[model samples]
Target: MSSTNERMFTRRDFFKFSGAFGAAAGLAVAVSACAPADTNSSAGQASTGADASALNEDGTITAAISYELGTNGYDPMVTSAALTVAANWHTLEGLTEIDAATGETYAALASSMPTANGTTAEVQLREGAKFHDGTDVTAEDVVFSFQRVLDPANNSLYASFIPFITDVTAKDDRTVEFTLAHEVGVFADRLAVVKIVPKAAVEADPDAFSANPVGTGPYRMTENGANKTIRFERFDDYTGPRPARAAKMEWQIIPDPSTRTNALQSKTVQAIDSVPYLSIDQLKATDTVESVQGFGLLFAMFNNEAGNPFADVRNRQAFLYAIDMGKVIQTGLSDQATPATSFLHEEHPNYKRAANVYSFDQARARELFAETGLTKMRLLCTDHDWVRKCTPLIQESLVAAGIEVEFTEKKSADVYNTIDGVPGAYDVVIAPGDPSVFGTDPDLLMRWWYAADTWTDTRMHWKGTAEYEQLQTILAEGLEATDSATQEQKWGEAFDLISEAVPLYPLFHRKTPTAWDGTTLVDFKPISVTGLTFVGVGSTK
Candidate 1:
């Protein structure tokens, strides 16, 4: 397959999970009724501040983030948490990279991208690229990195992203070659998903390495901010195209929406991500808040194991139809999210409305419930700051449809622990996910929930069924198709099958609102994913 260099926007975004994250999308441009001129982030320039002292002269850019550090650590090979992946963006490098702000992929560890169409492709590492630990980057490190992710015993979540690659071999000290299982057009940009790490450091102490990995990127992580704050310092010897524009970076892990907004307002931090929809208008008075729409979604996943009430597709459809998605979006999300028409948001370049859309139909919902005799069902939900806003309304809608909802809300990790591998723990789960944080391709997005081993075999228990086999077949065809049109058609068929299957699906694709003081932090743009990035940003303070 002839691959293009685009990853997330083209192919670079990654972290495929329905977990606690604040990340992307359509310009849900937060233009409150009384908006200020400076708040228009679409103006395409940094928003300047009047308080010169608030700017940092020490070249430090501080931010308040609403996402909690998930149970996982910062191993790019295994870490799927939004917070850690965002940190890895600055502290790690792929042979190619996705520009956080622009969604464009460019070579980072690789000096330049070579042209190749067949199974074999060679990558040349940039000369003199050094890890934060002062070790030189080598082709061997790149090979080791890919090998670990491909190792089945490791069971890296990213292994699903590049099933096409059979092996990665170092041709020389600085040159590596990729041997593909098959031809893939996205081979180049998909390289961003596996961030290169120092093999010596990782193999020496995998635990310590996960705690604070050493990489070839512009910044090195100092504090992981388990309960307090995360910190980074510039790698002065960095010789990459986008060096750290600041001397230091600090991210206050404030998961409370109100507290995060207050921190940004009080100037305790120069920027904040996952800005509450209700707080956007007021904060816009002082900061630049842009709600970019990405593929981030609030999903409804059903336990489809045998004997589970939701094992019946009709019950799953009934539950989805019962939820008044319109009110949920308008009131719970403050109209900051779009009701999902497909797995992908409508704005997604590859989106096609699923054949069956569960628009609010209380009567139809009741009809299906009566047919399936699903009177009482347990609902599992996560307490992620933003997800909290909608779960109550979801419960009410289900109750309104005459089904008893035994609602249980926990932190993202707890919710997954309750359901992962344990069948029938809950009939349905309402949570957040943004696989687009991984990339924008339909294959990557669909495989995240449908084809990935953990989600298919454990969480939803949809594997081994005829429908599951059919969906998998369609997905494989989509990935195998050489032409774009045929691939998209196959993907559309997968969406149609998923719509009817209803094992797990999206309720809506959300907008990510991020607040940053442009005057204090120069050239910093909000991404449509869950974490905050300050890659090319410089602080006036």
Candidate 2:
């Protein structure tokens, strides 16, 4: 594969030329101002054999997701909200994609695997592919989409996910090439992080384009809805492996878990995500509910900035020993979650037991606290319904260890913002995360928090520490290694260093519980991460 003289857009050029979007920005306005339509549809006739109901009269599927979609609009270049990206997963695509449930790699916009030689990959696009607007997908569109994400002015949240790609170019009408800065272990798996978008439509009216996404996937937007709801209809012209099984799809942004459960029980919505832990047995007895185990884990992170008690290793270890993680998983999360023995779950191919572990020992916790002479700490937790349920248990444990804890709760986005900015205000934070949603390979999962100057270095305040430097060296060696065995060994070395330092440690990897009427749908299965997948799924009606 040879490189072409395709135009490149760097971060610096984006700042200098961003003013050109003024006309398009001004021309852009809310495409739909109407409130989100009713989240549920009326119940139809019940079905037999499987625990499901008949499909809607119009043959549409209503899905209620617990997360909000308004934070970042539908634009692939900028959106970071997990649910927003998942919704677009059906409408938009990339050269390659990692299956959400199976973590298997498959071709999407491109025809086959890219032929890689060192730092470059050659990819051929699928022939005759057309966007929802009926325009042929061209090589120019592929090149332009990569440039936008690589451009720094856009500040795409997903930009850090693909740090290896140095440049991208189109070879011809049907082929494209990617140039990586260095050979990474999971370079191909990370391509799906950025979905390809049409250059002409986006450049013409970026805001309106986001409001109404146009892609080569199986679905097309019926309305340019925002905030509360987004609706889509099948693209009759789509020529892909997973075409739309239903005529229409409606996603209602319901933030409350109870509301979503009610919507599913009433048969108003065909499926719902984030099944409440308490309602799992009830739902499973009467309907279709599953608790799929994946990389979804709640991590306990410490802010090791100067003057904070957590900066001292003794303080950090003391906090971990005080709380019974097993109890947290059992009482708050039920049996759906497993206490994490290693950062990589046991099922992962690269799984390894950590070098050190945190176990319940109230006496050891008090001793460590006494060594630090610290008796009070401010604990920050996400305001998600289930997560909030775990805080009281944590508080009780800490109080039992003779430590006073002040708890504060906020939305998931708000909690991350405080940690990302005001590092001194918080001593500890417990939040749920799943990097495997992007790719299940161990390299991608570890790189999410351990890669240099990423979350662990910047947000967690461990940049200058000795353990941080050791972890970076391990990662660099892992990335450079060509053999799988060598890569696994390097990652294990990094995990050992992390286990000893304890900047942020996993409590447990919880199973993602999802409820849907199986009798009414075919090929529908629950996912382990934040997003809900409906590809290849159809209504029984």
RMSD of each: 7.6, 9.0
lDDT of 1 by residue, 163-248 (tens): 88898889899999988877777877688888999999888877667766778888877766643677888887798899887788
Best by lDDT: 1
Number of backbone collisions per candidate: 32, 0
Cα deviation of 60, candidate 1, in Å: 0.2
For all predicted structures, in order, the TM-scores are 0.90, 0.86
* Model 2 TM-score relative to the real fold: 0.86
RMSD of 2: 9.0
How far is 537's C-alpha from truth in model 2 (Å)? 0.6
Q: Write the per-residue lDDT of candidate 2 for residues 474-537, one digit (tens) a residue.
A: 8777877889989889988877887788888888777677788876776675666545777766
